[model samples]
Target: MDNLLDFFKAYDISLSQMIIVAIIFFVTIAMELSIRLFFRRYEKATQHSHTIKILFYLSLNKPLQLATMVIGFYFMAMHVLTWFRFTSFFDQVVTPGVELGLALCFFVLMNTFLSRLKTYSITKKTRTDGGYNNFAKIEQIHKLGQALTIAVMVFVIAAILGLKVAQGVAYLGGGLAIIALVFKDTISSVFGGLIIYLDSPYAVGDWIYTIDGTIQGTVEKISWRLTHIRTFDKRLIFTPNNLLITQAVVNASRMSNRRILQYIGLRYDDFDKFEAIQKDIYTYLGEHPDIDQNCLTLVNVVNGSTDMGSTTEGFFGGSSLNFQVYTFTKVTNWLKFQAIQDKIMMDIGRIIYRHDAEIAFTTMTLDISSEGAEPSPQAT
Candidate 1:
């Protein structure tokens, strides 16, 4: 050790400074390894927990390692420069650089911490009952938190660089004004997204349609400027958020039940069976498991004549007797509702057959009098 110090001393390098640097380097590596091992154990222990899974996804190991290295480098530089008698150089360049690096490390740590916290909040909320009902509000808060984190980071960086916060904000405000002017539509879309986030009209995975019937699809994602929709035909659409704000959208996924409306007609010959069949159909719907009995259900005869300007009772030009059936099904899923409706219709057909009644169809009957006197001869 004495010979090694003598060799470095001849080159004006202090062996003690070199030893300090070596210690810092090894200590930094040790800290990094310790953090890595700790996180690995934590991940294994909490693997089954979703909250822990999210935390693992947003782990602080990387930032913590970076910060440890930065701190170690700062100390090593300070010791080496002091031993070299470069006090002015250390004060002017090294000190400020170290401060800047430390500030940046702090910013990164804060950003990561904020992100982790926000993600945890959202994940926790999603696991609760009726969580979807407040998802939009939580999402909005998350976005706001991110923006604030970025703003605070910028302020800290500026302060480290000896910039006044008020001056920096003023410059930022002016720059933003110009940017807003240059990108008015984009800004509008951003505001539109904010409105959507706050209003909670429709959310991700909702089946929605425009009132004009032009756009109908399931919402896949909602970003700052656009909303992604997957159409029923398997096409993806990127629609501007502002456009959605201007239009009326129907959220089909929010419907409590699906409606079933039909008009059933019976042949006039089966008039005697009409009253019993109608009553039976109503009773079936009221008692069906798939039907929502709380909603409006109706099975009533058409009281007016089918012909225009006629006042006949349940007679459509004496061809058939018609009745309307209106009801609601408990299921709102498209495929499930269709299946239920099909079963109900088939059951109604069976009921009609059991009552000895036939569904009506258009038919014609003709009679010719002898006044024409043009009877064809028998086959000759």
Candidate 2:
């Protein structure tokens, strides 16, 4: 050390100060290497652990290296300043620079911790039964944590730089109020997102449709201001969260069973077979494996006008004998329900055919009265 210092003494460098700077520089490098080595070993050892893999995604090695470098730079700067007889600059600039660097390190560390915590929460929830029920809530909390982390870091950096934190916060509050006024719709959508988190009306992957039938799709994502839905046609829709709150939504995915309701009409000539056909259809539904026997199942002759104003009085004025079939299928999947419904409909048709009945279609009969007919004037 003496020889190294003496070598520089020719330029009037202080031996003791030079030695201290050298020590600081070596120590910084050693600390950086140590951190790097430690993290490398830790990563290798825990590579197979799922939890560790997630939590350690944000490594602290770089931040620690920066912190060590900053400390070394501060000490070297102070010693050099003293040698130059400019010690007054230490308090004005060097100290604040060190403080900012350290604060930045801490900010990064907090962010990393928060990120790990969020990953752990999501992992834990996904592993448990019924975890998806609260997934929206967890996402909301994670978003809130990130916002808070940033806000806190800003305040800390302000304080470190000799700014009055309270005054700055007051100014920020006022600015936010102005922003809110200018962006009322945006703010409302954010609140709507919060409501969804609390109410959990629907989660990602739920098939939903509006009561008015204007929108029908599967929920892809829910963010602060918008919810993404992928329509059946493969188009993506970005709906403002506020709209979801105001409109009535039906979560089709939650239905216990899919309904099959139909009105089957038979030709008036088949009126004699109506009772037998209805009985046979009802019996078939009761024995079907895909139908939900526990639900209300009906196969009845329509004796009067239906609520939809369809008259079923074949002998009175109607053209055909009408009967209604109402039942539910055990499967709620749309494709599977269609298959079951098709099979049932074909079977019903065969049953009617066996009874010598034909499904009815609209018909008209033309009549010419001899007394009122003028002989087609001789073909002109």
Candidate 3:
């Protein structure tokens, strides 16, 4: 040990400077790389093969290597200073120059990897279902992470290379009032995206019932700026995500299918014969390969009023069958739902007609005795 110290002194090294050199070699470089390599090998073994594996490793290795080089350079520089008795020069010369640049580079690299790690974690969480996500939400997150990483790297590297990012920040802050006035929607949208990810009220393919009377058929897509819903009628509705979050959303397809109800009214006079009429209708629907269950049907309990609780009869009145067919379509497919409904309607009409019962229609009877004075052609 004494000989090594004497030799370093012979080669121009002080005790404190020598200690820094050893620390940089063992701690900053050797130990750091050893730890990184250990994790790398372990990760490669356990993780499934992907085309991105090579690129990911290279990305990590580059920083690991660059860090090693940086520390090694400092060690060499320290040795020079110690040997030449230039310690004062080292402190005076390196701080504002080398140290700042080193620190900035480290910060940028560390931030980039941190961003990547977060992206990977979120991707894993999104794949909790293990089923393939056609929506590719996780993949999109990864892409966004990549973009942000590059942006941050560019920004920091620019400052390190002496482009004065702090000056830019100052100017930006000075003009923030103008920016806010001009880009209010843009700023709000960024915050809205954060809320979306945190709250996760609904995902793609969910059927959302808006409180404002608009029934969004399915979530076609969701972006940072907008949420798109495809209506049952094949129309697309683009809503700002911010506005959507503020509104009440009824998620029908959240872990389950939606329910649809239908009501049909038959003439009140169809009764007595209605009991037997319901028999075939119920049997067919019960045995139906598509109808959900035997829970779908009803007989005539016709209240003598409009079907929709209308107090006045306009051009319609009848002894209605008052059939309440309630069946859930097993699938969330709108087309399938409509097809099943059409079949049910057809069957109901055929059975009613086959039973020789008339579907009631509105009627008005005026006694001719009182109207004889003016039996107008319009009335006739």
Specify the highest-TM-score model's number: 1
lDDT of 1 at 253: 79
- After superposition, the stretches of candidate 2 with alpha carbons farther than 4 Å from their true spots are 1-138, 141-166, 212-216, 302-318, 354-356, 365-380
Whole-model lDDT values for every prediction: 0.78, 0.80, 0.63
Query: Which pairs of residues have clashing backbones in candidate 2?
Result: none
Superposing every Cα of model 3 onto the true structure, what RMSD results? Answer: 12.5
Best by lDDT: 2
| Cand. 2 Cα-lDDT | 0.80
The per-prediction tally of clashing pairs is: 0, 0, 7
Model 2: per-residue Cα lDDT over 1-380, one tens digit each: 87976656755776687788899889888988998888788768766674744454544766787798899899889888777667778988899889989888876776676667666666666623211233566666667776787787788788878789889889989998999999999999999988987788887767889999988999988888999999999999999999999999998877878899987878888878888898999999999998889999999765566532344353233566677899998877777788889999999999999998898876777886789666676843
The residue ranges of model 3 lying beyond 4 angstroms of the native Cα positions read: 1-185, 204-209, 214-221, 228-238, 251-255, 258-260, 294-321, 364-380
Candidate 1 lDDT, tens digit per residue, 166-270?
Answer: 998899999999999999999999999989987978877678899999889998888889999999999999989999999999988778788998777789889
RMSD vs true structure, all candidates: 5.6, 7.1, 12.5
Ranking by lDDT: 2, 1, 3
* Winner by lDDT between candidate 3 and candidate 1: 1
